[model samples]
Target chain A: MSSVNDIQNEIIEEFNILGDDKESTIFYIMELGGKLPDFPENERIDSNIIKGCQSKVWLTAKDDNDQIEFLADSNTDITKGLISLLIRVLSGKKPKEILDADLFFIDKIGMGNIIGSQRSNGLAAMIKQMKLYALAYQTKQNA
Target chain B: MSLNVDKIRDQFPVLHQEVNGRPLVYFDNAATTQKPQSVIDAISGYYKLDNSNIHRGAHTLADRATRYFEDTRAAVKEFINAREDSEIIFTKGTTESINLVASTYGRKFLTKGDEVLISAMEHHSNIVPWQMLCEEKEAVLKIIPVNDQGEIIYDEFEKLLSEKTKILSVIHVSNALGTINPVREMIQAAKKWGAKVFLDGAQSTSHLTIDVQELDCDFLAFSAHKLYGPTGLGILYGKREVLESMPPYQGGGEMIKEVSFEKTTYNDIPFKFEAGTPNIADVIAFKTALDFIREIGKSNIKNHEDELLRYASSSWSEIKGFIPVGIAKDKISVISFNIREMHPFDVGVMLDATGIAVRTGHHCTQPLMQRFGLEGTVRASFSVYNTKSEIDQMTEAVSKIAKIKNK
Candidate 1:
């Protein structure tokens, strides 16, 4: 299990290599998409689908013994990598932890500065979908 | 063409610049045309000489401002050959103008099971607004289908028009495809069903001669930026009776005659649609741009641009794997195409490296892209100032890019 500090280190290192420029960051994300883990057929469903995306994206979160985990895929290669980066920041936490987490980590990841308007918009849509999932999980747990 | 190409080119200061170690070849004219020196001077003169809020004030500056502001309305009325200046409403570009109608006019007149017809080749601005209106009104949104060449199938459109068709909002010229729509025929057919027709004139206003009375469209919308005027200003021309019938789009100053606590009486025709502080300087500057067009004459400009288009189409056709996207029998100067083995973005970037600027995207017509099964196209749209020499340069750049990508 990776600690929060460990994940933070991974993010920092990854961002350092990608640089802070928007064009470079998009290229980096596109490269990252080439290395993303594939999701199984059963994992691709409605809870994962993101609206307002030009590309089709599916993200699934698994709650295992109070820890949250996620896997995502997109038909668009660059968007797939973007989903992967999001999963890295958002996955592997409890529902409460995910709900409490600051998604502004995207700014720290340099995604806000590094992508084109459309790609950045797609990222925003993905982040919204992830946050919604966390909120739904919290509500279900509370209920 | 009798127009001096060199002299005309010199008038636009922005054109005399170097980008990436080469002279900038601006082909993004369909998206927005470059403003000439005269238009720029007119804009500056407005701010420096006559900077004041229009219509209401009695002060010296206000009187001058009001005169200049209202002068633009008169210019627009004459430009489109509308019956009166009262019919011309100034809004924030084509998108806002379209939305105003969908929200106000559509809400008032349309109901469940009614139809609003649009073409498949419309910009997302035209498509989304009506779709939203359809959702709210419980009306069905019908599409006038386009052929593979991006021309609307007139037979299909004729058959689609029915008594239930309340409105037919269509583009006069498709920004993405460059297809010059048969708007006169469309207006006649749609009118037979007692449907109001709105023409999206964003593309056509710059390229083609527009006479709203001649076309007989109930409403027409166009942007200043696309016509080589200032941005953030557009005209919405509606027939007096239709505009009077629709309620005011927003509640604000200038749009209302008297705002009491109990009830508010709206202002007449155009003012009822224009709310808040209008883009005064830009609106006034638009007169100079229109004057520039009038001086050149629309027919001469079209002929010059058509010559450039003919050169580009014939030259670019020679390149291997180069397929032009929109090939309607009647198209304006917009040439949208894709090269095999090259992504539209890659093609755009390559062209930029050679100082050629072309819009490489869905051109804000994603539904049109979806219809063609393409993500985007490399769009090289022309204007009055664009020369055949520039088209030759573009063709050369595209050919080189295609070869490099193919290799």
Candidate 2:
């Protein structure tokens, strides 16, 4: 299993080649989302939805021993790509590790310039939700 | 006379830039129109030379500021053909203007069991204020439903109107759908039932001619930014009698005639509604926007916009995945649509990459989107300065974007 930083570094390296061509970059993002595994339909309830997204995104997680595995889906392909990137880096990690993980890839890849202001806000919200899930599992473990 | 499109485009400095390494094709006029050089100059010029608090100033700067500010009010009176300058009340924008009426007029006048009639296509601004008013006053809020084409059902509107309706507040032209409502007839219909009429002209003031005395709406609200002026400035034109009847919107300096610890007497008509320091530079700059419109003339502006709409409407069918949302027969220059199987946000992002600025998402008319069974739509609104070439570029770009999903 790759560490969170290892995956983020891989993404940064992949994106650096596509550099400055927004059309190619956006299409690549969408292509990545196309390859994401289908999220469970039953788990796609309003309770699982993340707020602050212009497009609706459903995020659900299950604790596997000490590691948390996150499943996410979005109505928009670009938003799905964003959440999928998050899932790739943070999923299958211990709750404490996930909570402590630094998401430096978002800034390094210039996500703000690429997604515009609104989607950047949604990306921030999705990260917050993932960390909250991690915090919940951490509390359960402590208890 | 044909509008000098090139000359007009030259006047707007913002239109000359690139968004994402491509020349900008600004099709988001419904959100807010870009300001001209003259309007920009008017704003900075006010601050540079004539910045001072008006109405109670005892100095030279105040005198100049006061005169320029009132000149805008007078210019607005002429622009909308309101009876007098005193009838025009400056507020934050259309949202605040609507809120002012709801809070002051609706609070005092709206009673239990009375109906505050509005249309389903209203932006949240028009709908929320009435909803809040109804909740507090024990009044009922009635919505006039629109057809599949996004035109209001005239017969349904008539049925909704009754003796119970205290106010009939409706948008003159829908910002999302671009539907040009038959508000003149609706206003006339409401008048017979003794219901006050308020027209939200945020979209219409830029596209169509507004003559308040002719339309006979009790109140009309619109924003300056949408009319090629600055933000933070809007006009609320209430008939003198209607203005006199309503209580003050907020309490502070200019809105009062006399104030003591014991008692405070409010001012008259426009002053009673305008409280404290107003948006001075923006209001003054708005007059130049008004002048800009007058110099071109509304009819000429409409002619160019109509052509752009016609070209756009006819050309969209050739694209594989184009599905239009609002097909209203009487629309202004807006086209709201979706690409088949692709989300509006995705379409917007792709188009933005090509330097096309179109408003996506719900456009703040969530009920209208619900009515159409849509999450949201991609909206392209045009102005006089927009050319057919820009429309062509957007169409080609949208075609490329839509094909990515279709293929």
Candidate 3:
């Protein structure tokens, strides 16, 4: 399995190839979102809701054999794509690896340029929520 | 007479700029209009020349400032054709104006079992304050239903009206859908049942000719920013008898007559509601915006904006998977629609990339969205300065985005 940094670096390299073409980058991201696994309807409740988003987003996580797996969904295509990118980088990783991982690729690939200002705050909220889930799992593992 | 659209566009300096490497096409007029150069100049000119606190300062600048500030009230009174200048009260904006009525008029008039009737299409500002008032007074809050065509069902409203209905507050034109309500007819009907009528004219004042006497509405509230005027300024016009009856909304520096700690007499009608130092500079500058609109003539501006709305709506209907949200027969220059299976926010962002500014989300009218079974709609609203060419550009970009589904 690739390390978190290795996966982030791969994404950075992929997005870097797209260059300054905003439309193509947006379409590419949306296509990735379309490929995300179906999130369970039951889990899309208020408790799993991620705030600070213009569109509704739900995120859930569980520890599978000490590897954290995340499932997320958004009402908006771009937001869905954003979560899929995050999940692709951090899912199936150990709780400690997920918690310690840096998401510098977001700025490196200029994701802010594509997501716009308002949704950039939403992207930060998604990252914060995921890190919180990882921290919760890490605490449970110690016990 | 045909309007000179290019000349009008030249007066607004912000229209000349580019947003994202493309010339900006601002269709978010319902959210807030781009100020004309004259209005901007007037704002700065106030600070440069007549900068002083209004009313009480016994100085030369103060007198000039007071005259300019009160001049706006006179302009607004004439703009709306109110009965008297004293009937007009200045608040922070439409939201504050509505809150003042809800807290003061509602507190005094509404009692248990009294009903406050609002339409299905009210913005949150109109809905929330009444909800808060109803909750406090133990009064009943009722809604008049909106049809699929995005119009109020008159029969439903008639059925809902009763002696128990003490107040009827409705939007003159919907901010989200651009549905122009029959406020005059509704106000007349509500008055038959002895209910006070208030029109939320935040969206209408810029597009329509307003006559308070003709409508006979008990109160009317509107914001300046929506009318190409400066922000932080709004006008609330009330009937003389009604204004004199309601208790003071806020008590502070200006709103008091004589304060002896134990017995503090309140000031007269307009000054009684204007609690503290108002947005003096913005209020003074607002007269320039009103004058600008008058110079163009409201009817001429309306004709130009109506033409744009018709052109855009007809062109947009040709796109595949296009779903127009509000298809009211009578509307201002707003078009709210959604491309099938595309989130309104995504469409808005895609439009923004092409320097087309449209508004997305519930537009502060979540209940209206629920009525349409939608989370939100992409709204493109026009102003006097907007041209048909800009609408064509927007429609072309929207058409391209809609084709993304086929890919």
Give the better candidate number (1 or 2) by DockQ.
2
Report how closely model 1 matches the true complex, as a DockQ value: 0.08
CAPRI-style quality class for the chain A–B interface of candidate 1: incorrect
Output the TM-score of candidate 2: 0.97
Cα lDDT of model 1 by residue, B1-407, tens digit: 56787888888999999866678999999989999999999989988999999888979999989898899899999989999999999999999999999999999999999999999999999999999999988899999888899999999999999999999999999999899999999999899999999999999988888898989999999999998899999889999999999999998999899989999999987889887889999999999999989988889989989988898999999998898998999999989999985568656756776778899889999888999999899999998888888888888888876774455
Question: What overall lDDT goes with each candidate model?
Answer: 0.85, 0.94, 0.93
DockQ of 3: 0.60
True contacts kept of 1: 0.00
Per-residue lDDT of B1-407 in model 3, one digit per residue for the tens? 87998999999999999876779999999999999999999999999999999998899999999999999999999999998999999999999999999999999999999999999999999999999999999999999999999999999999999999999999999999999999989999999999999899999999999999999999999999998899988889999999899999998989999999689999998999999899999999999999999999999999999999989989999999889998999999999999998999889888887889999999999999999889999999999999989988998899999988734
Evaluated at residue B9, the lDDT of candidate 2 is 100
Cα displacement (angstroms), candidate 1, residue B8, comes to 1.1
Regions of candidate 1 where Cα sits further than 4 Å from its true position = A1-143
Poorest stretch of ten by lDDT in candidate 2 chain B: B398-407
Over A59-136, each residue of candidate 1 has an lDDT whose tens digit, in order, gives 777777667678888765557667777777678777766666666556677554444466677777877777777788
The residue-by-residue lDDT of candidate 2 on B194-237, one tens digit each, is: 99999999999999989999999999999999999999888999
If both were scored by TM-score, which would come out higher, candidate 1 or candidate 2?
Answer: 2
Positional deviation of B85 in candidate 2, in angstroms?
0.8
Give the fraction of reference interface contacts each candidate recovers: 0.00, 0.68, 0.41
Better of 1 and 3 by TM-score: 3
